[model samples]
Target: MTTLSDQDRARIAAAITEAEKSTSAEIICVVTRSSSDYWAAPFLWATLVALVWPWPLISITNLTASTIYLTQLVVYAVVALALSFPSSRRMSLTPSWIRRRRARLSAREHFFTQGLHRTVNRSGVLLFVSAAERYAEIMADDSVSVKIGESAWRPILDALRGALARNQLADGVVDAITACGAILAKELPPRENDRNELPDKVIVI
Candidate 1:
């Protein structure tokens, strides 16, 4: 697993600080282990396997009802425990689309939770990452989004995706912030009295 060190955190914070110099945009960066626990995945898979394991015993074995029931219980317990592991839950059991969707929702939630929406000019941008899902999103408040349009963010998101793939998170975030700063500078130049409405440090969860 790629881990974000303290050094990476500091670098990310510096990037955000530097990026905000020319633009009034308040950029908040967040990184999370995962968007969701996906507790249902293990149980759902275990249930399906356990349900079929007993049918084989019922058809060909001489086992009594109580014995078969106990066997099924053991199967369910073992399968569920195995799948409960973090790697197992993320890689094999959970669907890709579901993981992406959960990450998307989480990014949106953090956009508001981080107070990015409350900036005076609504010039707030959220850079969110879900490590387990390998997902990244650039969420801008209405003012920025309206001025730049959503498609303008595709290259930024692509850069983020590639960085996540290579486990170069700090570099990716720095690049993303710099790119976002350039756009914001052109379309939403810093106001004379503008002040940071969000934290410059990277939020890790």
Candidate 2:
């Protein structure tokens, strides 16, 4: 769930109006599925070993365990470095979408996500990020042109579109920007796997 301020939502409505006329601005909102998995497969095993090995220092075997601990620490450090530099997901917030989303989701749920979505008042640009769940989709306004797959984006869009048609400018802003594009899906069919595949309801966002 998102929680953006009302002022930001107003700004987004302004931005969306600006976007409709500007063709150069390619607004891309990517909702990546299973996207933010930072825990490497080996992370848990290494951490467990490190925690257990430090207590029994008297045994000669504990000396070997210390070596294991150092190795584990190094590996974890390396992975952390990689994530901080290269693997971190770009988290952007459509302030209006946040406010709109908050109507549907809780604040604690969106805690770790880094918010970067800022409407540049008619300035054409792009915004992309990976979200939760296991699917993604692209929309051209209220109409979803490309159903990439099911993910957090789908549900979010559904809510946004609902808000739009009803003339709810706040939540409608998200729908205003999200349009169809090259969708990356992994085996999950957009319709069959979708959790919120309601008919296109522009007023629901």
Give the candidate number with the greatest lDDT. Answer: 1
Displacement of residue 5 (Cα, Å) in model 1 is: 2.4
Candidate 1 worst ten-residue window by lDDT? 86-95
| Model 1 per-residue lDDT tens digits across residues 138-159 | 9999989889887888899999
Span of 10 residues, lowest total lDDT, candidate 2: 196-205
Model 2 C-alpha lDDT per residue in residues 1-205, reported as the tens digit of each score = 2333567455554454434332322243322222333444334444555566555654545467567667657766654444443333212211334333432232222211222122222211222222332122232221122323336356655655555445453444454354321231221223322222111112111
> Candidate 2 regions off by >4 Å?
1-19, 22-24, 34-36, 41-45, 51-54, 57-124, 133-173, 176-205
How much lDDT does each candidate structure score? 0.88, 0.35
- Candidate 1 Cα lDDT to native: 0.88
